[model samples]
Target: MDCDLLIIGGGVNGCGIARDAAGRGLKVLLVEQDDLAGHTSSASTKLIHGGLRYLEYYEFRLVREALIEREKLLHIAPHIIWPLRFVMPMPPTGRPGWMIRLGLFLYDHLGGRGSLPGSRGVPLNGPFGAGIKPDIARGFAYSDCWVEDSRLVVLNALDARERGADIRTRTRFTGAARDAEGWIATIAGEDGERTVRARAIVNAAGPWVDHVVGAARGAHPERPPRLVKGSHIIVPRLFDGEHAYILQNLDKRIAFAIPYERDFTLIGTTDVPWHDDPAAPAISVEETAYLCASVSRYFAKPVNPEDVVHSYSGVRPLFDDGSTSASAVTRDYVLKLGEENGPQILSVFGGKITTYRRLAEHALEKLAPFLPPMGEPWTDREPLPGGDVGDFELLLSEIRRRWPFLSERTSWRLARAYGSRVNRVLRDATSLAELGEDLGGGLHTREVDYLVTQEWARTADDILWRRSKLLLHVPPGTRERLERYLAR
Candidate 1:
């Protein structure tokens, strides 16, 4: 396949770049070694916040950029992105209330605060204290956004595909060589290997960034990425309120317990030095214990490893900024344009989900010298696939109205997952029976077919876990049945 750009990796950054590049009228081909968001992208804190903790490290630029993008992202993908309130309780051992107040002030006003609410003091004696200990009385409430992180990646890839980009998941970018004219790339997939030429290449390989660059250029980065593993554990709901909590750990780091899936409290995230493989980072015993203790410190009911129903871990390929602590490293991204080689290859190092769009804009700007002049940045105005509906609650109401046969639960799920595309998925199905076989996990054969044909889902894992968190809702037999249906 001859293309203007060949993008490696199917994580958020890679897909986001592809969507942007394709929108600009570039012939784009994105190859992912595994499923889209098979790794780090799927295992996020599921937050689109400006990293309030990064302020302490004096990462003002990163915070501002992320905060600005937070509102913009919410506007474009309102179906998957919604406003979330975070309550940070003050404790006797943690940072003083005044210090936190100062930080909140900066966080509230740092970037241009848009539709989302700003920071304010909240009395924990009320409903906010549902699971918190009585000793913690007052704290700060702030605004951020929650995202179905993996779904966000899929939507971007879908948009890219629609905009004339060939997005191939389960396909590996083996190697590439630059010559006097453009470059040649070797890709291997189920159908085997083939060579393609492109005018330029984008190495957005996330954790395996340096690995991809090394395979192609035969040179290692002078500064290797510091792989930091972040882990999260899910447990039964801790509080009845919709708001989430951000608790400060004794080690001065912060952890969060967010309300997830209507029935579970998603608590986590421990940052630890990772030396093991990035492909399969697992939550260590120590990490789980630490996360349990982190939330237990503030809540009345102690959360231990026993309470954890599910856990996951992912390694972040952060730029080695000489930071001693894993959590303190910069979340900023860098675009390295390869010169002296034949065709220019841009290798991306270190990026956060919130900044992926801007990173793509910057990436394409870096490649301007090699490719033909493309159109202006248009992603800022375009919505991702199934994200045209701006008002989520209204969208849900509309879905219920249009499909009177849909149950409230299913309507809510479909609205959140597919947004306006719910109409396309349910097509002509006036009854549940017409939607095909129920997979016993709130998953129907219809949804599975949509996932397979439209969303690039190959296995049960792609649908149950990444495309949707039905894994938490599905029974053990759900996967086998779903896979059986896919086989046909």
Candidate 2:
């Protein structure tokens, strides 16, 4: 196959780039070895924020860019991204009130303040302190965002594909050789090995970026990616409100306890140095204990390792800035455009989810010289598929009006998951029975088919874990039943 850009990664960055490039009238090909967001991207803390703690590292530029993108993303993908208020409790031993107030002040003004509310000091003795320790009487509240991280990635890929980009999931890019005209890349998949021709390449392979660079260029990266493992744990609801708590530890690290999946609290994340396989990173016992301890320190109800219902870990490929500690490394992205050896190849390193879109824009700007002429940037102005539904509450009401058979929860889930595309998933179905057989949880056959046929969901895991967070809510045999259906 021939294309203008060949992207090797299916994470948020890769998919975001593909979407932007394709919308600009470029022939884009994005190849992923597994399902979109099957790795680090799926395992994020599920946040779209300006990395509040990053301010401590003096990453003003990154924070400002991220804060700007935070509102922009919320504007474009309102269904999957929404504003979240965080309550940061003041600890006796942690940074003092004056310093924190200054930090929050910078945070409020950094992004040029948009629709989201500014930060404010709140008494922890009131509702914000419901489950917090009584002794910790004061704190601050600030705005961030909650995101369905994997869904964001999938939506970007879907948008790219709809824009005429060829998005191939479960296809691995082995290597590529440069030539005068462009570059020829090798890719492997279920069909077999094949070669593709492209004028330029983007190595947004996330954690495997260094490895991909080594294979394609026959040399390791000059500044190899630093892999830091971050872990999160899910437990029963920790507190009674829609708000989330950001707990500070004496060691200078912070952990969050956010409301998750309606029935659970998501507590995370610990920064631990990792130098092992990036494919499958598991939370160590120590990391789990640390997370529990971090939150337990402030909450009126103590959390223990035994209370953890589920835990996940992901290795972030950060730019090695010689930071002595893992938590201090910058979260800003670096676009390395290499044209010294041959045709141009841009390798992305050290980026957070909040800034993926900007990263894509910057990447295309870097690669513009080598590739054919393309259109001006437009991804930010338009909504991702299913995001056009304005006034989410009205949409939810309309969905419930149309499908009275669906429970309130199911209706809300469908509305949020597919947005305006919910109708496409429901089609002419007017009753629960018409929706098709129930798999488990709230999943039905109609939705499964839509995912498999439209969303590149080939396996049960893709449907259960990545396409949606149904795994945490579904019953035990749900996977087996879904797997059997997919096999047939």
Candidate 3:
């Protein structure tokens, strides 16, 4: 196979690049060893906000860019990306309230925050934050956006496919050799081995970037990718409202407890230096205990390991910054273009989900010199697949009117997950009988079929964990049944 661009890695960066490049009229090929977003991309805190904590490190440029992108993304994908308010409890033990207020003020005004509301001081003792402990008397509420991180990756891949990009999951790039014309790349999949010719190559493999660069056949040694591990835990909902919380740990690190999947709260993200292989970064017992303890300090209801419904860990392929502390490492991305000895190879390092779209735009800008004429930057104004809802509430009402038989909860779920694509998924199905067997909870065989046929779902995990959080709703036995069915 031959192509204009060959991107390795199916994570958010690679998928976003594929989408942007393909839409620009380039013949693009994206290959992933595992499923798309099977790694760090799916394991994010799922926020599309400017990093508030990054302000302390003086990452103004990155934070400003991310903040601007937040509103842009919300406008483009109202169904999946929506405004979320975060409450930061001002405890006497941590940073002073004045300092936090200043940070919030800067965060509110740093970017051109148009559609999202501005930050405000909220009384922690009042009804808005009554659940918080009395010691936390004051707090600040700020705007941000929540995203289905994994689904974002999938949608980008889908959009890329629609724009004429060859997206291959479960396909591995074993090696690549630069020749006089371009690159001769070796790829292996379930079927076997094949060679691909491309004028340029991109190593967007998160966490595996260094491995790819090192494995490139006859390529000069490049700067190694620094790997850092971050972990998150899932527990029962901690509060009654939709707002998320940003808590400060005694160690000065910040953690987030965001509402997730209707009934559960997603708490996370401990940054720890990781020297192990990036492919398998598991949550350590110390990290889990630290997370529970941090939440327990603020909430009346103590959270323990037993309360954790699920836990995940991911390795951030940070660009080597020589920082000793993992938390101090940069979250910004850097693109290394043109190889030391041969055809151009672009390697990406250290990027967050919130900036993936911008990262793609930057990557393509760097590669424009080598490629032919292409389309202009169009993603900033375009919506992702199923994200064209002009008004979210109207979309919800339309779903209710169309599926009057569906429970309000089910209708909301379908609308949020599929957005405008719900119509296609439910085409020609009038009644509950046409929806097929109820696998469990709100899941039905029809929905699973739609995922498999359209969303590249090949296993139970893809449907339950990546495509949707049906695993938390379904019975344990049902998962096994679904797994068995898919295995056949």
Candidate 4:
């Protein structure tokens, strides 16, 4: 096979680049060893915000760019992305209140404030104090966004495919050799090994970037990524409102208690240096204790280790800048283009989910000099697939009206998941029975078929976990039934 660009990873950066490159008139092919967003990209705190804590590290440029992209992304993908208000209580011990206020001020104005409301101080006593301790008096509230993180990756890959890019999941890019003309790469899949030619390659392999680099050559790069493990624990909902809390831990790191899956509170994310296999990173006992203690300090109810219902950990591949601590490492991306002689290759390192779009644009610019003249930048102005719906609430209302048989929860779930494409899932079905068998948690066979046919879902986990968080709500035998159905 022949292509213009061969991308090796199915995470946000790789899928984002494929979307951009394919739209720019390039023949793009992306191969992933696992499912799309099977790793780091799916394992975020699921926020699209200018990292508030990053301002403390003087990451002004990074914060500004993220703030700018925050609005752009909300505009382009409103179905899976929407505004989220973060309530930050002024910690009695951490950075003084004045310092936090200054940081919030910068965060509010940095990226040119958009439709979202700005920051303001409020007493942590009334509605804001619902689950808070009595001692903490006041804090600030600011706007960010909540994203269906994995869905974002799938949508990008879907858009890329619609625009002529070939996205091959469960396909591995084993190795590549560069020559004067281009790259001769070998990819392995269920069918076996195959060789393909490409004008260039993009290594966006997330945690395995250095490993991929080694596969291209015989040795690892001089500077490998500093693997920082970030872990999150999900507990039963701690508070009532749609808003989330950003608590400051005594150790200076922050933990968030966000409402998740409607019935659970998602708490997380400790920055611990990791050295083990990146493929399977699990939260340690110490990390779990740390998270529970961190949130316990703020909420009136203390969280214990036993309270955790589920937990996940992802290893971030940060560019080694020699930072003293994992928390201090920069979240900014660095694109390292190969030496200017042979077939061009670009490696991406250390980027946040909020900045993936910008990183994709930058990646293409770096590769532009080596490849054919491509189209101008266009992702910013266009909407991703199914995001063309003008108003989300209006779309939800229409879906409910069209299918009064659907419960409010199901209607909202379908509208949020498929957006304008919900019609395709519903088809001409006038009743729930017509939609096909109820697998579990209202996930019907019809929708599963849509996911399998339209979204490249090959397994039950792809539908339950990554494509949607139905795993948390589905019955115990849901997976087994779905698996059996897929087999048939």
Candidate 5:
């Protein structure tokens, strides 16, 4: 096979670049070792916002760019990306109220925010925060956006595929060598090994970037990606509203407690350095205790380690800034194009899900010299697959009306997960029996089939975890049954 671009890693950065490049009329091929977003891309706090705390690090440029992208993304993907308010309950000991207010003010005005609301002062002692302890007196509420991170990656790849790009999942790029004309690359999939030719290669392998450059493709030794491990814990919902909370710890680090999967609250993200391989990163017991203790400080109902139902960890492939502290490392991506070789390899280091689109645009800008004359940036204005719903509420109502037999909760789930694509997923099915066999926990065989055929779901975990959060809803025995079915 031959293409203009051969991208390794199906994470957000790789898929985003593939989508942008393919839209610009470049022949693109993307290969992932596992499933798309089976790694760090899916394991995130899942917020699409300007990094509020990065202000302390003087990352004004990054903050501003991310803030602007937030609104743009929300507009393009209203079904998956929507406005989320965050409540920062002022702690008496941490940064003073004035300082918090100043940061919130800068956050509001730094970007040219149009659709999302700006920050507002919330009385620390009011009913909105009535559950808070007496020590926390004042707070600030600001706007941000939330996303199903894995879905974002899949949608990008899906859009790329729609635009004549070949997406090969569970395929590994074993090695690549630069020749006089282009790059000769070898890839391994379940069937066998194959070779491909490409003018350029993209190493957006997240935590495996350096490994890919040094070991896989034999590129020049360049800046290494700093591996920072972050973790999140899921527990029973603590609050009723859609708004999330950003709580400060004694160590000055911030933790997020956001509404997740309907009945659960997702809290986490402790930034700690790790020297181990990225593929095996897991949450430590100490990390779990630390997160629970941090949230326990302010909430009326304290969270203990036992309360955690699920925990996940990811390693951030951050660009090394020579900073000793992991939290101080920048989240901004660095795109390095090799000067020695004509077969250009663009490596992305350090990025968040919130800024993946802009990261994609920047990657193309670096590769413009090598690329054929292509169209200007167009993703910002275009909607992702199933994201074309003009009004989310109206779409939900229509789904409920069409599937009057479906419970309100089930209809909402389908709408949120499939977006406008729900129509196709449920096509020609009228009654519950027509939907096919019940796999238990509101999961039917029809939905699983849709995921497998449409969303590239190969295993039960892909459907349970990434494509949907049905793992949280299903009973243990049902999950076992699904696993057995997939194994067969």
Candidate 6:
């Protein structure tokens, strides 16, 4: 097979590049060794906002770009991305009240705040104060967004596929060699090894960026990515409202306690220096204790290690800028373009989900000389797959109206997950029975079929974890049942 661009790694960066390039009329081929977003992309804090913490590091350009992208993304994918108000509890000794206010002012004005609301002072003594201790009386609230992170990757891949890009998850780009004409990539899938040629190659292999670069010829870059491990824990809901809380730790690191999966609260992300395998990193007992302690400081109800129901850890492929602290490392991406004469390779290093689209746009521009003269950049205003609906609630209402038999929970799930594509899954199925077998935990045959057929889901984990986040809610036997069904 031959294409204009071949992307390695199916994370946000790779998928985003594929979507953008394909939209610009480039024949794109993307291959991932494991499931799409099987690593860092899925295990994020899942926030779309300017890195408020980065202000201390003077990352003004990075923060401003991310903030602008946040609003643009929310507009394009309203179903998957919505405004989230983050409540930050102020500590007297932390940064001083004046500094906090000044930071919020900068955050609000840094980017042109479009549809999302700006920051404001809120009294923590009221309903939001229930979980808080008496010392912290007031805090500031700022607007960001919550994204279905993994789903965002899938939707981008889906859009890329619809636009004639080949997105092959579970396929590895084992090796590649460049010639005068193009790069010949050795792709290994379940079927076996095959060769695909492309004029240019995009190495967006999140954590394994260096590993992928070795496939060609030259040694890795002088400044490689320092692997930083960030872990999150899921416990029973800590606070009541739909809002999330950003807790400040004694170490000056920030942790988020966001409402997740309806019944649970997602607390996370300890930035620890990591050197272990990037493919799979387990949360240490100490890290769990740290997260629990971080949230316990702010909430009225204390959280212990035992309270954690589920936890996840991922290694961020951050560009090593010689920052002493892992938290201090910049989240801004570094796109290094390869040889000027030979088949080009653009290696992406260090990026957050909030800036993936802009990163994609930049990636294409970097490779513009090698690529064919194609369409203009068009991903900005265009919606991702199933994001054409005006609003999430309106789409949910439409689902319920069309299928009155669907319970509120079911409709809401379908509307949020499938977005405007809900009708495609619900096609011709008038009643619950017609929707087919229940594999347990609200997942039905209709939805499973849609995922398997349309979304390139080959395993139960793809549907359960990345596609829908039903992994936490599903029963013990849910995986087995889904696996058995797939086998047939």
Q: Which regions in candidate 4 have their CA more than 4 angstroms from the true location?
A: 218-220
Stretches > 4 Å off in candidate 6: 218-220
The lDDT, on a scale of 0 to 1, for candidate 6 is: 0.89
Candidate 2 clashes between residue pairs 3 or more apart in a chain or in different chains: none
Per-residue CA lDDT of model 1 for 1-488, tens digit only, reads: 39999999999999999999999999999999999999999999999989999989899999999999998899899999999999999898989888898998998888875888889999999987788999899989999999999999999999999999999988998888877778798999999999999999998888888888887862335466889999999999999899999999999999999999998999878888888789989998999999988988888999989989999999899889898988888889978887654688888888889999999999999898889789999998788888889678899988888788777877888899998888778998888898899997668888888888998999988998998888898767888888888888
Question: What is the per-residue lDDT of model 5 for residues 5-116, given as tens digits with 9 covering 90 to 100?
Answer: 9999999999999999999999999999998899899899999989999999999999999998988889888888888889998876889878888998899999975787
How do all the candidates rank in terms of lDDT, highest first? 4, 2, 1, 6, 3, 5
- As a TM-score, model 1 comes out at 0.98
Candidate 5: residue pairs that collide: none
Clashing pairs in 1: none
Candidate-wise lDDT, in order: 0.89, 0.91, 0.88, 0.92, 0.88, 0.89
Candidate 5 regions exceeding 4 Å error are 216-218
Model 2 ranges off by over 4 Å: 218-220
Error of 3 at 362 (Å): 0.6
lDDT digits (tens) for residues 361-419 of candidate 6 = 99999899888998888998999988999967777877888899987777888889889
The true-versus-predicted C-alpha distance at residue 176 of model 1, in Å, is 1.0
- Quote the positional error of residue 42 for candidate 1 in Å: 0.6
Between which residue pairs do clashes occur in model 3?
none
Model 3 Cα lDDT, one tens digit per residue, 111-166? 96578888888888765574577777888888899999899999999999999999
Selected candidate, larger TM-score, 2 vs 5: 2
Q: What is the lDDT of residue 169 in candidate 3?
A: 88
TM-score of each: 0.98, 0.98, 0.97, 0.98, 0.97, 0.98
- Model 6 earns a TM-score of 0.98
1-488 per-residue lDDT for model 4 (tens digits):
39999999999999999999999999999999999999999999999989999998999999999999999999999999999989998867877988888999999999996899999998998887669998999988999999999999999999999999999999998898887788899999989999999988999999999988988852225499999999999999999889999989887888898999899999988999999999999999999999999999988899999999889999999999999999999999999987667678899999999999999999999999878789999999799888999999999999989999998888989999999989999998999999899999999999999999999898987999899999888888999999999999
